[model samples]
Target chain A: MEIISFASAVAGLGILGIIFGTGLAYASVKFAVEEDPKKIEIDEALPGANCGACGFAGCSSYAEAVAKGEEGIDSCPVGGEELIEKIADIMGVAASSSDEKKTAKVLCQGGNQETFNKAEYQGVPSCQAASMVDNFKSCQYGCLGFGDCAAVCDFDAIVMNDNGLPEIDPDKCAECGVCVTECPRSLIEIVSSNEDVITNCKSALKGKEVKVVCEKGCFGCTICAKKCPVDAIEMEDNLPVVDTEGCIGCGVCVKNCPTDAFVEVDF
Target chain B: MQELFLLFMAASITNNFVLMQFLGICPFLGVSKEVPTAFSMGLATTFVMVTSAVVTWLVETVILVPLGIEYLQYIAFILVISSFVQLTELFVKKVSPPLYKALGIFLPLITTNCAILGLALLISMEGYGFIQSAVFGLGAGVGFTIAIVLMAGIRERLEFADVPKPLKGAPITLLVAGIMALAFTGLAM
Candidate 1:
């Protein structure tokens, strides 16, 4: 009798479990979302770094975009060329390789030795906070003599030289733009490192107007503007804008600039 | 409805899984330092918990009991949880790409998250019916979310304040968690 009772108990549990299991399986399948298998394939083809370097949230999102035809495959900066090829092959499309590999270079030459600091800042010495609020230093456009750029760099390409200015290592640069995004002064720019030379100074005020507040100020002095033989350099609001298309990497502007603001990053 | 309220009360304050029981502490600590990240992790964990509870209840009721393979529950539960999360991830990625983006990697990582496992175990151990299990899972997830998010907001503010050397980093955070647990313990009465 006890054996029969035990068997019945087991059977009771079994039937209850079976009923619940079937119900659950039904709900799971019923509520189950329809997902594209192609997105998974594309995601697998991606580098899976989750770096968010491609302006999307993550690699999976990028894959979904590729599947829906919303995004091109080459936008991933960290994925490089090989991953691009993998993605193209997965999609059964011919790989488009027109996007040139571009590198980032700092346009300005304003190191600590180049620009004079008004006073030694005691508090948070980060460039972002310094740019946001004036410190003991008098100038507003000053690099704040802080090394926030050096701090956030993932590749260790940027280091604070003894002069209290960030110097970029030519070989170590991955062109990740952490520094460009980190800088509070908007001092960092993603210029084409390979194309040609660039003007670093962002000062718009003319020579006399700029010189009073800053010693390193590039006064609307059009020295580079007058010297460019190809008319590639244009002087706007005391700043020199180079038309990168026509300017043929001529050494004329670098030599002519009296403040020496226009210099090569040696990319 | 009453069952859901009871589960909510239990998960949100009284039985409080994260602050009280200490399941799923890895993400609670790692991701809780930032508000946005902690919030997203909480939501993703909740979604996984609710779904897993429903599925595990079914697997136990239907597959194992009838066949008398009751001993295989542990491994079977784990297998079902992982595969379910993976299938859900793929499905969500295809249909709602935006949700997958917003949730980030936590969408897939929650498969191994112990909180989901614990919720499944808790419901089974308590011998909860289907409705009771769902409510309990929902409550537990809410509890976890509340704990992590509150910690995140406090940590963000704490970043500006000057903290002592020994109490800096993990130490201070843990101390804060203790205080939070103490505070939530008051909810029991």
Candidate 2:
């Protein structure tokens, strides 16, 4: 329109524009990295939970593993066997199904009914701390009942009961072990889901001393161990240990406990 | 070189698109729950940001200035940004279909990402030369990407965190953002 002052503009900025744009275009082309598309797909096929149960840091690394053909099939523990099987089908690899059906169970049954507190705990009542000095309660191996495990469960698998104890919902728990790591007292343990009987009491004290402390406390009495017909129960550190395979869910041990410590959970 | 480096750092941290400028908070909060979604959104925004900056600069310098239609900046920028996003969407679809799908519906949603518009406005307002403006836009995009991805990582951990009931949802996120802002203070110095 104004004689198209193009010559003047080119004189002012055309060379600079050309130089910069070309430099950028070159950089964009030169620095481009070829990324595999399947890496993303494999990652999407993953449960997207990022539960960190697969030994990898998160899902992205798991996706990288799936793409690289390095790691074996079944890695994501939270995704479970079904997800691993699907991933194996996608990657055209053999599915390594780990049949370990484990669920987190609280070892301590010393609720408000059983335990007495030496001192009132205030501020971040972690089980680890309760285990240090004067325990929040009298029993050393009892649940601090601070609900730390309830706090870390991604699924609503845990609810703190009225007695300051966390009850784990076995169906909702994926056994990611986040709660296991989060618990300070180490009272939470993973046992086979099929295991109907486990010693809720982890204390090693014996006889009347343990009975005086808590209503649900187990004294290291070998009566349950000695009276077992299948040799499943054994006295270890004064506490009766039930071998999971040998435990046929028989209530013989429950019937024999003098302190009502070894109550049958399923029976 | 110092100007370029300082511009890069300033755009990335001192004037972050997500946390500082609060430019792309929609995608920052929305798509940041998962690393994959957050990453895809960041990458797509980066792509859109760089493209719009280049085209808008060209339009502003070549056509608008020459034609004395500088008043048409907001309209011109919007039109160019929309077309550029559409083209980028098509390009991503053709070039990287999986990423396109991964980007999914968020691609279209990014058309509304104000960070792109903000970059266009800032570049035009600052009167940066084409390369400087493009660099600024890229820096803003990278800054946005960094913010959202870090947010995603934190949110993943937060899913298992024992945050209080009163601090759930936006309250906790705001607290996290405040902490992140405090963390960013180190970079500002």
Candidate 3:
């Protein structure tokens, strides 16, 4: 009886396996979807970061778009230049060197020391949370210093400095613009690395209010705008907007600004 | 009729597969990110659970008990459950392309989901008849759907919430799951 039971168990299981195996094999062939071979290849070739930096859901969706010729090969910023070349080679197209390497610029210089607090914000230690609850920072338009931008940066390129402002490492920044969207005050901007000048402040307050708020606030004294030899600086809403096309990188604005709101880009 | 109704309610709510029993947690957490996706996963799992329950019940009664090899129940149940999952995947892919895309890799993952196996084992362990096993499986699946859908709704809201930095992603999700489990205890009369 024991031997018969053992044989029955083995035979029963073995029969079941064969039945399931055949059933699955038949179903797979019967229900096969016609997938694009090139899409699979492109998916393998592309960096599978799925960061949504390319405006797609993930690497697979992006690959499908590229395979269908719906998206350009240069759309992926996280992959950088090498991925572009690889994709171009797969697609049988000449790789366009269209992307200029960019870096994130923190437009606010009003760190913890530079600005006074209107209230002691004891809420959640996130920029979004701080900004929503009356923004304790004296400058309403400055970095909240809670490192919301730093938190979203997938590349680990952003760090909160001693003064509670984000310091971006240019070398590691992929310019994916995730940090740009993360900032509650929209203080972070992606700019061409080769740009010679950047405004270190985003304060829109008038000269008097600016003085009351932050030492580093752009008081709109119009010194840099007046000093611009090529009329590259325009005063808009009590802030100096630098026009890169007409600006000569002479560092005149950097030198002339009393509050030192404009600084020459180091890199 | 009353007994069947009670059995269904107990399986779906009081003895909920995901919340109360804590089976099939992988998909419960992984697929509960969005409402639509979570609903789809729940439905797919429900279909598999019901079918596997009936099939495994037949296997236990007709084959294992007759052969006096009830110890082979585990392997036999696993084989039956995995095959049904594969068959379901094929049917879903052929019938609805959008759902197939939405489910993505999760469709195949149901093969390993312990909830279906647990239902099969529970049915046989309780010596339930074929009709009773089927009803129990359906109830268990409905229970899973409710738990996952609830989790997804809360997670969607949590996206905009000011969750603390340390408890942002997985930690907060686990905390929410724990809280949900505690809340479900209220239904356990």
Candidate 4:
């Protein structure tokens, strides 16, 4: 009697498994939905970070949009140009040539070597925290040097050097624009990799006031603005703003700036 | 009718799955980030719970009781619940792509949700008849929905409030969950 009951239990459970398994198998085939082969290929080629840097919910959704020709291949900043080429090859279309590979630029040169300290900030070591406090730097508009941008970079592209300024590695940067918003002083800008001349100062103070705080501050000298061959450099609120469209990739502004405010970035 | 009403009231409020019993806390916290998503998850869970309850009850009465193989109840209940979830996923994908998209990963995730399993176990333990088991399942699902939707509404408002840096994100969410649990205790009275 005991042997018969044990055999029945095994048979019963086995039958249950087989029944459910076969039923599910039939249902899966009956309810199968068709998906684009190109979308799957595109999704596989993508970085799959699903960072939402492409304005889509995730990598797969972005792939669907790209497959259907709704969004451009260059929309994914995290994937950069190489992924665009791969995606374009899958879609059998030429990638957009006008979209340049971009990188972030730290617009301030107010490192520890160049600037003076107003007070020793003993509060939070974060830039946001230091900014909320009295802001220890003499130049209020300078980089807080608390490495907030460095901390926020998902790609580990930005590093805080001994000089206390974030050194952005151009090759590693995907230009996701995370660091641009992370800075408390808004001292970071996304610029074209090939573009060179950059005003590395953000202080609105006059030359004398700027000289009192930072050694490399762009104190409204306007020399680069005046000397630009195409008039691309403009002095706005004591800082040089480069009109990217109008400017050529010449080192003329770099050659003229007295305080070394303009830097020639090597792309 | 009164006994059924009492059972439902007791299951939904006094013996709540998420708050009182703490059975499906994962979705209660995870999917409760937005109201629409939480409500959809709630509805999906409810549908699965009610259906699985009926099926599992039939399996217990028709097979396990007669065979006296009651020890295999857990394994049998799990098999039925997971297969049903798979079938529902396929049917939903074919019939309503929008809802499938909205539910997203949470639809398949319902297979692992212990609340459904707990409902099945409780039904068998309490020896509820077919109609009582269905009522209990429905009530449990409704309780889960109310808890999650209420949490989603609170979290949406929390986004704008001035939260301390350390207490942001998960910390604040847990604090809110604790307070909500405390408030639900009043419903027991």
Per-residue lDDT of candidate 4, residues A117-186 (tens digit) = 9887797789998888765799999998989999899789999999999999988987889999999999
Q: How accurately is candidate 4 docked according to DockQ?
A: 0.21
Tens digits of per-residue lDDT for model 1, B54-104: 988987777666555656677668777876776676566556768766674
Clashing pairs in 2: A220-A238
Off by over 4 Å in 4: A35-102, A106-173, A178-189, A199-255
Poorest stretch of ten by lDDT in candidate 4 chain B? B102-111
Q: What's the true lDDT of residue A130 in model 3?
A: 81
Q: Could you give the fnat of all candidates in order?
A: 0.00, 0.00, 0.41, 0.35
> Could you give the interface RMSD of candidate 1 in angstroms?
8.8
List all candidate RMSDs to the true structure.
Answer: 8.0, 10.8, 7.9, 8.6
Whichever of 2 and 4 has more DockQ, that candidate is: 4
Ranking by TM-score: 4, 3, 1, 2
Per-residue lDDT of model 1, residues A169-239, tens digit only: 75676667888888876677766555566667776656775676565557767878888899988888678
TM-score of chain A of each: 0.61, 0.64, 0.69, 0.69
lDDT of 4 at A103: 84
lDDT of 2 by residue, A102-189 (tens): 6788888889878888678776566655556666577877888878789778788999999888998877887779988888777888
Winner by lDDT: 4
Per-prediction DockQ scores? 0.15, 0.08, 0.28, 0.21
Residue A129, candidate 3: alpha-carbon lDDT = 88
**TM-score of the candidate numbered 4?**
0.65
Worst 10 residues of 2 chain B by lDDT: B100-109
- Model 2 is docked with a DockQ of 0.08
